[model samples]
Target chain A: MSPSKSPLIAVVDYGLGNLRSVSKALELTGAEVIVSSKPKDLLSASGVVFPGVGAFYRGMENLRERKLNSALFKIIKEGKPFLGICLGLQLLFTFSWEHGDTKGLDIIEGRVKRFEGNVKVPHMGWNQVKQTQDSSPKTKDLFQGIPDNSYFYFVHSYFVVPKDKSLIAATTEYGGEFTSCVCKENIFGVQFHPEKSGPLGLQILKNFIDIINDSQT
Target chain B: MFSKRIIPCLDVKDGRVVKGINFVNLRDAGSPTEQAKVYSNENADELVFLDITASSDHRKTMLEVVKATAEQVFIPFTVGGGIRNIEDIRTLLHAGADKVSINTAAVENPKLVKDASWEFGSQCIVVAIDAKRKKSVTSNQNPEWEVYTYGGRKPTGIDVVEWAREVESLGAGEILLTSMDRDGTKEGYDLELTRSVSEAVNIPVIASGGVGKLEHLYDGLTLGKADAVLAASIFHYGEYSIKQTKQYLKDKGIPIRL
Candidate 1:
């Protein structure tokens, strides 16, 4: 077992953050974890984890308020291993129609839309996430130890619709097939809360840390 | 597909899960952390820790338990009992509780729900309602479920269905609907009450209490139309593992994580 020399993963604390659980899981992956909202801390860190639970507009507003938005973009542009959860995943898209027209970070090309139809909004509970491709980068990197049709805890109404289908690392069918995970090289986004998804979730975090270790050596 | 959730509720008293019979009896099930670790691995959708004896010191102990569980178990869990204000919710959430359920406080001061939801999104604010069913004489419809608070010791004279709508409107992400009459009896869930509340609100309603058998879970999901089902004794006593319950639901053609 690797004894904490694993990588410094700065879990961005944007006020509305899931820091404790995320850091706990990250540390279990043997990575040194830091919860910081400052840009400098994120710059020095090996990886950044953006875990949020809130409305998309408010989340974006918070990132902007804390000036962490620019820091996030800097980290991502540098090709640092980035993992986004829930609202963090939704913020990666182009825009969301959550309450009204709200612009996102636009890192990934997609429109965040709410779950329409008779299927309930704020789709909460343990749902299955199927890997879109057998050997995609996200599959090789994130889903390394995770199996197909694995269940991850999800509690969100809005789902991302990335324009590029291949970017969809995984898909979970709530009312219909929506992108549950979006992966483009170093950038990985999961609509589910991995920090709260049990062993399968821990495995996903472990896989992310492994990606960090690989990039280092 | 969105699988129906099967939640196991842990009644925490003095940092240990105790039996449901009485509060003072204190038949220790196990450490909250260990039991949570077991359930996390068991593929349980979620876990709820109700602070039975919610003292100030007890709250601190529960926070430690929550931290320990968060370190070990990666799945989502909620903390309830004696959550009087937004500060309590904030402290619990910071300590790694995914969601915080407010029963007594929420009823006494409905603003707590709105305020908590405003501070920390509705997704994390779970308002637990312990409701008792009363036969409706004037209305020819079904019986009326009355809201009971203070751990089911006090009746608020509030309608269960109406209160559910109020909470949802106040930004409660979900409603933990517990049937007091059906609780611990193991007969089954209050399907009529469950269906009424489920139909009343747009937010997700979790049907809690009264779950004796595996079929009760199915009934909560199908017949009761609840988004999720919460049980305590069935899982705690080893009567059935989360695996057995999930398998039962899956066999019954309900979407569940195997």
Candidate 2:
């Protein structure tokens, strides 16, 4: 695929997110990116990404205010690939109990809950992720050719528990078994920050870009 | 699992690696790029280049040396000394440095730590502290050590442990603590100093200065609770190799990359 035809990945910047690092990582994979807060830019892109770092409620509220809620739903329903990272993943769940009872995107039938275990709250540093479901090209496409238990960087205080077990693409042992990654049809999310996961993280992004490029061919 | 790291630090002056006996009587080791390539071949996890001179003429020369060394060495490297502003950090990082270590500048202007962390992320900012034992003069004097700046030339008069906690809160990703008393002594790391600073901050602590043998590396990790061990004279003078040090640590059941 030509560089221009390769899907322009839209990294949504809703005024509060770590978009620079994510954008730089994607750019390293030879993917053209447009970091935009405009609904038109997000809707026109081939792939949409919801990248966030802070509270889920604030993120969802920003998206709704910008009319990106309808734009994202329309794009996802169109069967185009979508990736959610960290808070972006939490926003996909039905609701979150972070500061109060806050509703999420409800795209996936899951609830985001605070970490309740003996392990540390942030779950910082490097940790291993074990693959559970083999569906979705992201399973082998994103994590392709890597070791079964390759370590990825993680920094979070909450995790998602999908109501449907089929959506759980990977699980990791933090305090216990917790969903580290999830995928459903064209929608996918990772609890950990892949951009900061070092070489393994870079490979996952490369795979995602390759899949996007292949779709055009 | 994350493997433990072994690092070698080179004190550079006028674009050349220099080693001093007891922090004085400096002698040129070799070209910075040549020495860095040798360490890279030996499987050193990371390398630290500290510019020991304070000359403006030498700083530009060192920048060129860093660019050349970074071109040859692929492993993560940190450059320190006389970094006063964000532009200096940006220049070094653009020249292929994975991280930048700030000492005197960070202490002089604490806000620089936050600014650098914001600009290049927390993982790229490392704070280096030179600590020395303070003799108790009066009953009211604090028991903690004192912090020094300007290549250990001037005393900052700040409590070492307190300053470590403050810097970490200011957004330093890691702390490279060197014991001025034990440096170049080839005895062992100052476990008391290392343990004190490691316990003071949440970030990783790299123990530098006195690392004479393999046991010293293990001592830093196990006893001192250091995230990484840094040596100079032993590695620079060819007394020990990075591979040998890592092998010893691995054999001792310590988590290290071989």
Candidate 3:
């Protein structure tokens, strides 16, 4: 892939989350990765990846405080291929009970709730994610070239519950069934970290690139 | 079920594997990145790189090694040793480490643990505790384990169980519990110490040190109730491959990646 023709994807930096590893992984997939906090830089990118690593309330607070929420909404509104990771995925929901009821982006009608049952909190390590029964951008692109039930690295205590189960692109089992990947039009959110999820993880990033390429045409 | 993790740890001094370079330790252990790649290929669940260097000059070298290893090895990797503050954690994470293990610093200034947990998120902060079993459990004596710092040279007099609970509440996501007495002895893990700490906390505990054979790994998980087992010498010296270790765990009906 020519450098000039390669997609310049912006990894939105809200002063939180692991941006370096994501940037490095994106670069390896032949995309020009940029760690940018500026709204203009993120908006101008061919693809935007919003990632988070902290509490739910803090994540929304940072996004709003840095004016990234508006910038992110604008990027999504423009039909850009947007990817939200972990807490970034939760931020798109309506509210989270993480630290006493925090509001989210509401881009998708969902509520983030803590995992409760006999299982351990902060569900770490690799677990299988099965693609939903449909042929959309998710199975057709985000997870393209990857098999269903493929294991991916996950580390989160709370999982998002989309109001419409149809919005769930993939599902994973921890204490019980939880939405692992949610897709709504051009926006994609995954609870698992593709960067640290090993080879299949890297493949997910590459698959996103394909979606970005498809969008340009 | 979340599979039991088998982690291979490498000790580095000035960017070179300790014993391999110094000729005093183990010798011929190989470079960290090379060993790390080999472990990744062997299907080790995760890798931990400890920069045991005291010189500031080698800190940058460690970062380069971490960067190269992170670039080549595609798995969860953690870096520890000499991490004093959140800035150190940030620098290492920026170099591509998935997590940072805070030991002496977390003990000296407990606030550093809270600060790091918030800055990098609790999942990224691993509080590594080196605990030594207190002699005798008489009514007048303290609890079973005491937290030690400065390479186990200084005893903080803090109860290991209490410390384990404190770190978790302080926002630590995981604990790397090492037995100072069992370290390098290869007898097996301090099962009592591991059980006490694991039972006392809600987060995952990685039982480290004192592993001479494969059964020890099983005992660490089943007997000690640990989430993971970190072995250095046993796997580093080529006595056992990660494949064989996972097979042993599997045969014992333990949930493993293999």
Candidate 4:
């Protein structure tokens, strides 16, 4: 948050993850990124990000083994804003139904379920998200100046269904109305991979950084 | 929905853009970089640079040409020709090329497609297939087509339809299918070839070769179901600027960047 010191953000790297791209994107925003599997780095970081791809159970197992679970909970409890992407977002739910039952961070009440129907399993490519419940300051805060119905790059089949409908920030339609992003107090999660979303996606990251900058000030 | 794309393909040989007749009668089009700049200024939606000589020459020179072209052009550019491994893809990507196209190398070793996609995201990888229709020797041949490599010189004996699906599953984000029979003919794209490949794959299909007039471009998009139309002869010989072609398409209610 200090103008002179680069904002140090810890990207949780738990052996099986997409650490490099998440780190690169943060670096593009002029933030000092420290990719760490260590709990100590997570405790000391000003901002924390959980960027992941691939299966749900494996991602949770890696996070739990590395003890990132407790550290992340503590960081969020301290009201430090946290962002989760894809499996990162799915990890925040109470449980995921992928490859059997897998417990999540439980920061928000939700469950991840596989997309059902005749369509492709992995809902790939760009899809537009329709924003809902604009009352929350984080709504305007996280989305920033991006236009309504702006498309974000997506590559996932399972989506988050928040227990508290109030927590839902945006919804996108593939088979039906599914949660694309959710915000609860200091925590934020997105089901889409923003780094690969091109310019519009970069703006979302910029917005998150701006929020961090403002909160610290 | 996104606008349909009009792409100008520059087949580069020895760092210069060149055009050939059915993969022969090679003539210099211009400097690859210079030609790219012209396309960029002319409002071309995208540019494709095929290192036509990748198999015949050292790989480093192709990278150099890509580096130079990337420096001059701002719009998205896809580079192909002689990309053999992940390192080759990485080199071109680091040089500022938006996407890397793998053809012969992918057909030679199918693993290259998956490896490249894993190393760099699938969006950055494209598979270029040069296809030609086989004359019916017997009625039992099913009137099918075969895939050709080394600029349509060597037949792979692989069915064009089946190979397209395999590459798409291997995480190729798009397919650049060129019809050798239609190359330099200026009649139109091989609609049968384009439609078959487009239907076979879920990813975006780019129709290449035999684009003569604006209507041919339209046929590629409307009839052929190609997401993009890639032409060289029409654009290279100054028969039409990309802007004019785009305007023609747009006037016909086909979405295109003006």
lDDT of each: 0.86, 0.77, 0.86, 0.77
Q: In model 3, how large is the Cα lDDT of residue B255?
A: 82
Off by over 4 Å in 4: A1-6, A12-30, A35-39, A52-71, A94-124, A133-135, A155-159, A175-177, A191-198, B1-101, B111-126, B137-143, B168-174, B183-188, B210-218, B227-258
lDDT of 2 by residue, A1-217 (tens): 3244456999987754435557777877667899998878887887777777656677777888877888778878887778888888888889998768799889999898877755434444456788874556656666776677776666566789899998898888866888988988778788877765555676777777776676556
Per-candidate RMSD vs. true structure? 3.1, 6.7, 3.4, 6.4
TM, every model? 0.93, 0.68, 0.92, 0.70
lDDT string for model 3 (A107-205, tens) is: 999899998877756788878888897847555678777888887888888999999888889999887899999998999999999988777888999
Fnat of candidate 3 is 0.49
Docking class of 1: medium
> Chain A TM-score of each model, in the order shown?
0.95, 0.93, 0.96, 0.94
Ranking by DockQ: 1, 3, 2, 4
Model 3, CA-based lDDT: 0.86
Which segments of candidate 3 are over 4 A away from where they belong? Answer: A1-5, A135-137, B20-30, B138-143
- Residue B3, model 2: lDDT of 54
List, residue by residue over A1-217, the lDDT tens digit for candidate 4.
Answer: 3244467888888754335445666777767889888989987887888887666777777887887888888888999878988878888899988768889888888799987864444565456777775548886788877777776666665888899999899988776778888988878899876665545666777777777776788
lDDT of 4 at A5: 42
Off by over 4 Å in 2: A1-79, A83-125, A133-137, A153-167, A171-179, A190-199, B6-80, B83-100, B109-125, B137-143, B169-172, B231-247
Name the lDDT value of residue B244 in candidate 2: 86
* lDDT (tens digit, per residue) of candidate 4 on B29-137: 3677777767766767678888867444566777787766654454567898777788778778777676789989999999999987765656677899988888863
